[model samples]
Target chain A: MTDVASKEQKLSAEENISSKILTIYLIWSVIISVSIIIVGTILFIVTGKSGYNMENLNSLITAKGSLSTYPFYIQSIWSGVLTLKPFAIIQLGVLILLLTPFGRMLLQVFIFLYEKDTTFAIIALVVFAILLFSLYMVNILEALHIA
Target chain B: MIYIVIGYLMEILVASIAAGIIGALGGLGGGVLIVPFLTLYFHVPISLAIGASIVSVIATSSGSAAAYVRDKISNIRIGTFLVLFTTTGAILGAFIEHITPVKVLFFIFGIVLIISVIPMLKKIGEEVPNVERNDPLAEKLGLYGEYYDSVLKREVKYKVTGVKPGAAMMFMAGTISGLLGIGSGAFKVLAMDLAMRLPIKVSTTTSNFMIGVTAAASAGIYFFTGDVNPFIAAPVAIGVLLGAIIGTKILVRIRSSSVRKIFAVIILIVGLEMILRGAGVI
Candidate 1:
């Protein structure tokens, strides 16, 4: 009981710093991404055109439409960004939304290692490895589709 | 043409807010509601619906977790420790998503959800769990913490046990997240609150924190599949984020026991719907 209390006190002191950093970072990213999404949605509503095509809105809402096989490649997303396309901009927000957790996990693994918590550090490493592997799996799946 | 788009976007935005609130409260990741709403009502392609739901789940988890983690209520130790299982499970589930029929997947997920609720129903209104057993792994990993309960006006400390089983359950939770493009908060909460013997609030907020990481892995694959359409993702993300923020606010003020009951009921309803839908009745 006393040992538990001592441990709690120790964590609240140092763990406090990392927790604060995570909170601020998460908040800012969500704000940035949500802002971008709002702007992109507004731009599309007003202009009726994004770099891809205004017609995409048709299939977008259509039931069981053509979106299944259409994979929005990162390369195209980059090109779309260069052109300031609204849909691309929104996808950028989506990308950020997707990346936030990746960032958090990476940050956590670093923190665990820095604190010399080997067990958690190793666990976090495994999680990080799995995260990276999932991305690669996507490419493999896409390739298999082409083949 | 513009009006139609406006209507669709507006409707989704409103529905997503409700989904976001429920998801944040229950740690569900919001996909459970979003996918069905998009498909059954809007006639969205299953792939597209899955894509959008995965993205929205990310939004809800991150949005709600911001406060929970900052407040130190989310148990970062346990969250980080458990993420390994979920991430691995999610990868497998995402791969299976490509091969399996979604209805069959939802049915299994539904059964899991319903089963999880039974344990929770017995302990509804429990503010803090009284755990007697100790797991050496949990102790070595320091899987215990303290948080302030604003509603109770007291500091609550909790110890963790059942490390192996809880981790096993988290893997299933992660697979459900990947399979359904949801946070699978129900399963996560059950794993912690039941298997791991955590306080309901701790279980919920920690689940909220972990769901994002779990969903993010599979969401990556969904991205390239073009399941994540910007048109669908945009409003869902925006509304769910807004709603999740609201949920976190409500969470701190309510009694933990009530939170458990709410989680139980929500699980019950969503589970039944999924089963019915999976059976092609809906």
Candidate 2:
């Protein structure tokens, strides 16, 4: 009734700043997401044209056969025999960025009803970026046997 | 038939519904429900499933927290303070996960889940003091607020303290998140409700509000490390999100004490199973 409506209004007002930013971020994220799909498809097609066999490509993605290397902590049981595909790494990067700030923000605006402090919200976004970067680096290093 | 998309979407829808529902409940954190679904049902890789689960945890956190805030059930200032510690913990946990074995990581995670269920069964409807004297630290930290209680039919004011213990618990919660890829929902709620001793409602809302930021911090790393597969994550995230919303909506009406006990028992069984599997005993 009136109380519920008033409560909703008050809540929206409180979260106005964060909500606006979140909206902009969401739009940006969709663009990035579509781009990732396009790029992945193109990469897959071009790789196929270059005579990369679908069987090998699918296996690499499906984590069948020897996983080329331990990128993260757990390398799939398929490791020694199968040759590692280079495109998989780039695709993985694409997947990672797809879940980035823009992506996270897109989901957050739709999901959260609470108003977070703008400063804190911004900090959270930055921390998210850093965490992803670290993970990527860890995987890359592990793959290269650098670490 | 485009069955992959349909199957994927359907799976996500189910998980999201569950996460949403459980998240709305005061203490049944959404992460607990979502992770298992991803692992068992969809056959998602553990790392990717964990990544997706963490993201869904954030979604659940945001949805539930926002509702509670609108309802005037959460203490904002205190919640924010607790988030600072949990956020830091989440980052640390994500990095620590880089070094841990996946099987051992899951083993420990199941143990934590089992431990959390005990408290949820203890206090069903214990009313807390409305106006605790503001501790000096709480006063300085601005950890005081007022909320309207629906059951009591009045506005309730409270002062929050227990900074040291709250911070400690959040750190542990963060570690759990990093290691397990579960959202650490149960641990976060327990910390706020049991360790900080906030009202059940306040604890639940605040915990939900904070989880998204915490998960986001680590989920980024999860993605970059090639842990998030859209094919896998899409279904898992979507399912858990829908589930959590549904869970939250129905939470208040249900007799939660017995439900929580059952949930606890389920977690115990699952945890033991995972351990046995990991240990090669199963």
Clashes by residue pair, model 1? A63-B43, B27-B185, B125-B257
TM-score of chain B of each: 0.94, 0.87
Model 2 chain B: worst 10 consecutive residues (lDDT sum)? B1-10
Worst 10 residues of 2 chain A by lDDT: A72-81
Docking class of 1: medium
lDDT of 2 by residue, B197-262 (tens): 676667766666566656766776675565654444444444455566566666554553544555
Residue B171 of candidate 2: its Cα lDDT? 79
Predicted complexes: DockQ each: 0.58, 0.12
TM-score of chain A of 1: 0.82
The top-ranked prediction according to TM-score is 1
Tell me the interface RMSD of model 2, in angstroms.
6.8
Interface RMSD of each: 2.8, 6.8
